[model samples]
Target: MLDVLAGHAARVRAADPLAGGQDRLPKPGLGEQLVEVPGAVGLASMDRSGLDTLNATWGPLVVHRLHARVGGPDPEAALGALLDAWTAAPRREPGPLAVLWPSRDTAAVRALAVRGFAPTVTVAARPRRPPAGQATDPRVRPATADDLDGIARLYEALVAYDAQFGWVTPRPSTPARIREHLTGTLPRSWAWVAEHDGTVTGVVIVDPPPRSRWIASMVTRMPAAYLGVMYADPAVRGRGVGAALAAAAHARLDAWGVATTLLHHAVANPLSGPFWARQGYRPVHTQWVRQGRPSAR
Candidate 1:
């Protein structure tokens, strides 16, 4: 089963160079992680002969990693069967089920759509390197403890903007929570804030990607960084605040000898999708979701 999954993963990676080149399977000793569709049990047991998919629960969220068979008999039907089995499977928790696949896997995407999955978030990655030109904005500098309040203000604006797109549910405590979280990240992580006329207008946070069993299995285990948060005041939009902040962050990450940087953004977000693309990030994995009950379309 592991070999079969590795073959599918290789195909997925070959289809897109930026892909992570691995799939997350349920940890060993977990019972019944693999489910074979009716009449496909024998085929599924043979190496590389049948489709392999992984289902796991992360907190309240159920995640399905769909694998498409290369040169399988009816690739679409195979994926559809897997989706049907996954949706009908009993769950220990209730929450949105997210189906993830390589962005280049159109067959699995079509099958997922038929199974009522809708593309939601796109995880993108890019090599860490210095921006082509130095940022002229001297206002963009390493964040200091005194800048916490300003950073929190910028985060509040970011949350408010994202709320418009249903990315966050804002509560009165949201700003305070963000400030507390940023406060903890300040000393250990690299952060920079963009200032305009003595007022911070933007902020970017960089941190080492959290190491997990899932990440350690990737074929290319290079030092990587994560863009934890990058937000600019709406009032400062289109004034190059975000670009300057990102450039500054990239310079720092590059100096740390990071090979790649990754971030996730909502595909439905009009601002984030195009903004990150302009920043040279390319979609590597796409997370499709089905909320509530599955509906055939």
Candidate 2:
């Protein structure tokens, strides 16, 4: 298990070398502080530089973001302290308190929602199932290296969909970046496209569990997998392409023997919440991320 985490950390380092790059971020105890609790250990990575960046960008908000893995003794105390530190931090404004959790943790996740942190997004997924039917459609196939362009375009669509919130950076979403991510150490990162009469209608990207950071949080050392990042072209919105792609992805994962799969959807996206609900997914967890300057007093 440690080796797997280490490998994942390495891959992430390779992808984003600027974010501590195999030095500060990946090391277990090198973080600013390690708060120990039963069944969990909180690792605070708030270095002076990190804190300074937050203070500058967030304007007087002492943003204390801690990433803790629940594996020690008691996690509740550690989590409590982490949250308390953020809430009590001296901010010019009330700001926001946020935590990202694997959507499978319904109770703990919903608890935060009830504590005034409304859910910003809910990613839902269909657990892996056995391959019951061969993909009769000619559009969907195992993604080959040559299909990188289509995959990138697919990701662009997904990112554009996310841009409505204005949180994503306006960067060049290109094929090279998509290739780096899809071909990286993250296993089962597959893509498929829908073509009809020689024209591409939609695309789907399916990544297995444990490879995904979100899944890694809840499915650690478990015999489960996840499904994520399903997007369809807007031109084919009501043509059943999205459902077909999603169903195919589910069948692929199920054949892989993943106990369950998961993904997140924006609560803000119209009809998204209901669309997944109709597909046998429920509100398993709620995550909130409120961004603002600190109190200006």
Candidate 3:
């Protein structure tokens, strides 16, 4: 557990050099502490003494720790403290702390802004509903092993679009990779495709979260949620084809009893943000970075 925590700290440091990293926390003897918070699993790797010291010395740490515990009872007070701490800290420096939260958390969103974080990307938490106002003429069906090549082409297009922003670029899409993602028998892990007369026009893929990670984190015993890739031929952009493909993917998840879905979209995408918002999504937590200063753009 300590090793894992150390490794995680190393990753945090690598991603943001200005963050004090593990060195900010009092040394190890602080056995791992895990708590269930409102929107996420709260973990503090240091021990009680370390935590107490942090609360005493750093006003920001005090606010963060208190918020972790009693924020539910007085949300606004906790939020205020968070904002105060954020103001005291310099912007453009990597935060010594990091948190993973559900994208729907309003408090987390506010906290990010307080910490001088910016909305780097947007994640949409879409609920599963029947596809609305669309249909495909040649018809849509589950994508099988045979449709691997077409799926690869669609994934490639999606990844290429992702490259327009940020540093973590996805690999070039390929058939082998598509097959690998769909090999197992698992709920909410499936694919769908639309074909026109003698040609494939659109494709998508859905994958449920893995079981082990949830169990380890004690999130829940329930089956995981789903995410996917989507793409349609440019010629059919406004023709309801993308919506149909999305509806088909949602249908597959619903059949598997997955009602909640999550997906990442570049904040710069013109249509994607409003499209998901119309589908009922709001911002949760964002992945923020500091190039030279602390303000979120």
Candidate 4:
């Protein structure tokens, strides 16, 4: 397994230097499957069940994830074999099957495409850059516990907008959960809100490196930070509120000497793609998913 992973890592490095060697996988649980595709690179299936609240708020209710070590003479065939084995097996549970592949690995994308997968989200990264060109936007200020109501409101707007893109959804508990989370982290995490005429119009939340360990492995850079949440009200779209909030977040991350600032955005979000691009983030890992009929399981 180590040898196979090493070979795959080498190929990924050649394809995109920005994508670091992140091929290791955790031990699979009871329902997971380790596929055997003879002469194929490697395949490990994951069951992202058992955590209902976490999964529903962040992703599909039940997700079947894949770790495909594709990078050989014929990566497509290898990935195809993994998919064939996966499909032939009876599915006891369902949601969407996701495979996170390097954005630059165009060769492996074919296997996923033919199997009904579409790239829905991208984990983007930006290296350390100079601090904000000017003073922090006067309209953007550090969030306080007092701003919970406003921050939560903008968060709901964000979820509602992103839900239409088919990746995120809101549950009955989502609002309370979000409120609870923000209540706990507002004072500790790097959070900011944009105020237009005294009404909060935008919100930005980035997890400090210490709090970003959950996603740090996705990138090779050290001392990484994760931009967990960001939303701008539709009423204030054309204005620079969103940009101001983002600039504030970037300035904070830069001051911390972060090597990489990472965030995930839905591929279907027409606005997010261009917005994050302008913010200097690019796709390092593209999360491709195959769904059943409608959106969720």
Q: Which candidate is the best by lDDT?
A: 4
Worst 10 residues of 4 by lDDT: 42-51
- lDDT per residue for candidate 2 within 1-297, as digits (tens), equals 343235434543443332221222235555255544433344444322222231232122333444534322233443454455545545442434455544443323333544565667664545444567755465565556665667666766676676565333224323445557766622457566777675556766655655665454432233444555667678778777777776777677667676556666777877567767766665543456555442410
TM-score of each prediction: 0.79, 0.63, 0.56, 0.93
Angstrom error at residue 67, model 3: 12
Cα deviation at 146, candidate 4, in Å, is: 0.9
Tens-digit lDDT track of model 4 for 64-178: 7777775467777877887777767776666777888899877767888998899999999989997756787788999988889999998888888888878777777788888
- Model 3 stretches with alpha carbons more than 4 Å out: 1-111, 128-139, 170-188, 208-223, 280-285, 291-297
Highest TM-score scorer: 4
Compute the lDDT for candidate 1: 0.64
Candidate 3 lDDT over residue span 106-222, tens digit each: 433465566654555654555556644345444567777677667667665665575565422343223344445445432245667788784667876667556323312212223
lDDT tens per residue, model 1, 199-228: 988899877655322442232435767776
Report the candidate with higher TM-score, 2 versus 4.
Answer: 4
lDDT of each: 0.64, 0.51, 0.47, 0.80
Residue 275 displacement in candidate 2 (angstroms): 2.9
The runs of at least 3 residues in candidate 1 whose Cα sits more than 4 Å from the true structure, single-residue gaps closed, are 21-24, 28-32, 38-73, 130-136, 171-173, 209-221, 293-297
Better model by lDDT: candidate 1 vs candidate 4: 4
Better of 1 and 2 by lDDT: 1
Could you tell me the lDDT of residue 113 within candidate 3?
A: 61
